[model samples]
Target: MQFQTFSSPHTDRPNSVDKVMLQVILALLPGVLAMTWYFGPGVLINIVIATLSAVAFEALVLKLRKRPVMPTLHDLSAVVTAILFAIAVPPLLPWWLTVIGMAFAIIMVKQLYGGLGYNPFNPAMAAYVLLLISWPIPMTSWLPPAVLSTNPLDFMQIVSAIFTGSPPTGLEWDAITMATPLDGMRTNLDQGQMISEISQSPVWGDFGGLGWEWVGNWFLMGGLWLIYKRTITWHIPLAFFAGLTGLAMITFLFDPESYPFALFHVFSGGAILGAFFIATDPVTACTTRKGQLIYGVAIGMLVYIIRTWGGYPDAVAFAVLLLNMAAPTIDYYTRPQVFGHGDNHG
Candidate 1:
C-alpha cells in the first residue's frame, strides 16, 4: 500500500499578515479622526500624500528586489507604515518633506532592511527622527487647535501651506502655530518657570493639555479595543504606562515645581500612541510575554529620560527605536523553555 505524506493536523494560525496590518489601520482610525478634527485639514492632506507615497515606494522596491509585488501590496503593511509616519509628522510640513520622509521610510528603512519582519527599527519612527534632525523648525511647527486658529485652513489652504510654506491667502502656519504641551513644558522649564505656573496657561487643562488629553484618551480607547479584539496583549501597554508613571511620579515628587505631573506625561505627546501601537509592533518588538513587558518598560523609561533631559520635547520615536534595538536580547532571555527539555542549570 502506497502511503502519502501527511502534514500536521494543525495548520499555521489562520491570521494572515494582511489581517494583522488591517486591524492596526482600523485601530488607528479614532486617533486619526481626533487629530484631524483638532488640527485641521492639513493632517488629512498629509495622510493622503504619505499613504500614496508609501505604496508607490513599496511597489518600486519590490519590483527591483524581484519580490512578488501584488501579495505584499495587498498586505497593507506599507499603508499602515505610511499612516503612522504621516501622523507623527507636523501637520504643516511641506509636501516634498512628506514625500521624502515616506520614501526613506519605505525604501531605506523598511524594504532595504529586508522588508517588514526583518527591519530592526520602526520605519515610521526612523523617518520621523530623520526629519526632525534635518528640519527642526518645520518638524515642530504645530498649529493651535482649530478653536484657537484665527483663520482655520480649508482643504486648499492646507494644501497651499503644505506645498508652499504659506496658506492660500498668504497666512503662514507660524501665525497660528502654538507650542505643544511637551514643548511648552520644556520651554517653561528652561526659562526657570514652575510646572504649576505653566499649568495655568490656556494650553493646559485638568489632566493634560486641552486638545492633547482628548486625543490621547481616544488613542487609549482604540488601544483597549485592540486588546479586546485579541490583536495585542495588555502586558506591553500596561507596563509602558506604569514605567512612564513611575518615573514621572518620582520626578514630580522630588520637585513638583520643575516637573509636570505623571498624568501629564501619560497624556501628552505621543506617549499613548507609543505605548499601544508602536511598542506592540509584533515584528519589531519582543515576542514573549515577559520580554514584551520588559521591552515596554524600557521604552517608557527611555521616553521619560529623553523628554526630561534630552533635546527633544517628545521622545517616542527615540524611545521606541532604543527598545527595538533590545528586542532580540529581551526575547532570548525571556523565552520559555521547551516542555520536555530538562533544566540546563547544574
Candidate 2:
C-alpha cells in the first residue's frame, strides 16, 4: 500500500521580488520629490550615482562568488538598497563617499551575509551608520532648505560640490550648509536652553523643522499608499509610531521644557522614514505577525531613548541596527504552533 504525501501548505504569493521593489521605488517618489523641492537637486543626483554604483558593486560581488549576475540585479533589491542609503546620507555627500557606502552595503553587509533574504540586518541602515561614524564632518553637513538657504547653489554648483568638495567661487561651505534640526536641537539643549526658547529659531516649523516636516509628511503619505496597496502590512509601522509617540507624550507632559512634543518627535527627523521604510524591511524585520510588533516597538523606543539621552541627536540607524540583532530571537519566541499541535505560553 502507498500513502499520498505532500509538503506543508504554502500559499503562492502573487507578489514577486521585482514587483515589490518596483512598488517601493514608486512609493518613494512623493518624498523624494518633496525633498528635491525643498532642498535642491542634490538628492536626485545622489540617487542616480548611488544606484549606478550599487548595481556595479552588486555585479562585481556576484561575479567574484560565481553567482548569476543579471538574475540578481533584475530583482531590483540592489537599487532599493542604494536609494534608501542615498536618502539617508546628506544630499550633497561626495560622490566617492556615496560609492564607498554602496560598496560596503552591497558587498560587505548584504552579500557577505548570503544576500537578500539571508541578510540579518538592513543594508541601507547599516551603511548609513558606517558612513556617519566614518565621516562625521561630511555626514552632518546637510544643506538648509532652499527657502532658508542664503546661497542656493545651482545644478552645476551642486554637482561641483559633490564631485570636488568645493562650493561656488563666492560661496563658502558655511554659507551653503547647516546642521539638521535634530542636530541643532541637541546642541541647544546641551547648552541648557529650554525647548520653548529653542523652538523660537527660524528653523522651527509647525511641528518639525522648516521644510523638513513637509518632507516627512510626503514620506508618511507614500508609506500609507504602500499599506493600502498591500505591498507591506501595517503591523510594524503602527506599533513603531505608537511606541515612539507614547514615550514622547509621557515625557513632554512631565516637562515640556525639556522634551519636545510627541508630534514633533514624529515629524522632526527620520522617525517617519524609518518607521515606514527602514523598519519595514522584510528580510531584516520579524517574520511572524506577533514578533513584528515587538521588533518595531522596541526599535521605536530605542530611537527615542538614544536621541533623548544618548550622544546622537538622531538615532534611527542605531536603533534599527540594534533591533535587527533581536528580530530572530523575537520570531523564535513568537512562532505560532500548528492548528492540531497546541502550545501554551511559557
Candidate 3:
C-alpha cells in the first residue's frame, strides 16, 4: 500500500483569516461603545458609513481585478479596516470624505499592492494619513465630549451633519466641535501655559481628557482580552508602552512644568488603540519575535517624538507607517537561528 506525500507538519492552525478578523472586531466593540457614549451616535454613524463604503469599494476592486469577490469579502478584513478608519476620524466628518477614504484604502493601499497579505503599509493608516494631510479642517473637526458640548448632537443632527456638513437648525459648528485632548495640550503648551493650569480645565480628566481617559481604559480592557484570547502576543504592546513612557518620563522629569505627565501620554489620543490593534497588524508588522519588540518600541518612541515636537498633535498613524517600512529590515536583523544549523553552514 502507498501513501501520498504531504508538506511539513500536519497540525491544523487554530486561527483563520476570517476568525482573526472576527475576533478583532469583537475586541473593538467595547471601545466603540465607549466612544459612542462619550461622543454620541455620530460614532456609530461613522462606523456604518465606513463599513458599507469599504465593502462596496473592495467588491468593486475585486470585480475589476477578476478575482473571487465573496470569498475575500467573507474574510472580514475590509470591515476591520473600515472600523479603524472610521474611529480614527471625526465622527462628524462628511460622508463623501468617508467614502473617498475607503476607496483609497481598499483600491490603492490594499488591492493595488496585491490584496491583504501583500500590502506594505497598513491600509487604514495610509488612508487616514491621506485624509489628514489632504483635509486637515474636516479631519480635525472633532465633536466635544457629550459632557462638555454646549450642544450635544442627537442622532438626526449627527446624521445631518455627516451628510450635509451643517449643524442642526439653531446650533453653530463652534458650539459642537472642540479640539481633542492631545491637540488642546499641544496648543496650550505652545502658548506657554503650565500643565497644572491646563489640567484644571473642565475638559481635563484624571489622567487625560474627560471621557477620553475612560475610552482609553475600555480599549485597554479589550486589548487585554485579545491577548488572553491568544489573538495577539504581549511583546509589541509591552514594548510600545515601555518606549513611550520611557521617553515621556525623561521629558517630564527634565521639567514637569513644561511637559505633561507620562500617564497623560498613555491615556490620551490613540496610544492604547495603536499599541494593541494598529501596530500589531500581523501582515505589516514584524514577523520575528525579537523584531516585534524593536518594531513596537521604535513606533512608541516615534509617537512621543512627533507629538512633542512635530506638527501633528497625535502621531500613531505616522509612527505605525514609519515602522511598517522598517519591519522587513528589523526581521532580517533579528531572525532566529535554526536548530542544528551553524553560522558557517555555507
For candidate 1, list the clashing residue pairs, or say none.
none
lDDT tens digits, residue span 1-346, model 2? 4444466545544539999999999999999999999989999999999999999999999999999999899999999999898888888899999999999999999999988899888999888899899899999999999889888789999999999977779888788899998899889888999999999999899988999999999999999999999988999999999889989989999999989998888888899999998999999999899999998899889989998999878899999999999999999999998787666645
Angstrom error of the Cα, residue 256, model 2: value is 0.3
Worst 10 residues of 3 by lDDT: 1-10
Query: lDDT tens string, model 1, 1-346?
Result: 4444467754545538899888889989999999998998788789999999999999999999999999889989889888888888879889999999998899998999899899998989999999999999889989887766777767776777888876567555567687888998899889989877888887787878778888898888889999998989999999998889999999999998998889999888999998889889888899999999999888888889999999998999998998889999999999998887867756
Indicate the TM-score of model 3. Answer: 0.96
TM-score (all chains, Cα) for each model: 0.94, 0.95, 0.96
User: Which of 2 and 3 is the better model by lDDT?
Assistant: 3
Q: Candidate 1: which stretches are off by over 4 Å?
A: 1-15, 167-170, 344-346
Evaluate candidate 3 by giving its C-alpha RMSD to the native, one decimal: 2.4
Q: Pick the candidate with the highest lDDT.
A: 3
Query: Over the full model, what C-alpha lDDT does candidate 2 score relative to the true structure?
Result: 0.91
Writing each residue's lDDT as its tens digit, candidate 3 over 115-203 gives 98999999999999999999999999899888888776678888999999888898887778999999999999999999999999999
Ranking by TM-score: 3, 2, 1
Candidates 2 and 3 compared: the better one by TM-score is: 3
* Top-scoring candidate (TM-score): 3
Q: Put the candidates in lDDT order, highest first.
A: 3, 2, 1
lDDT score for residue 166 of model 1: 65
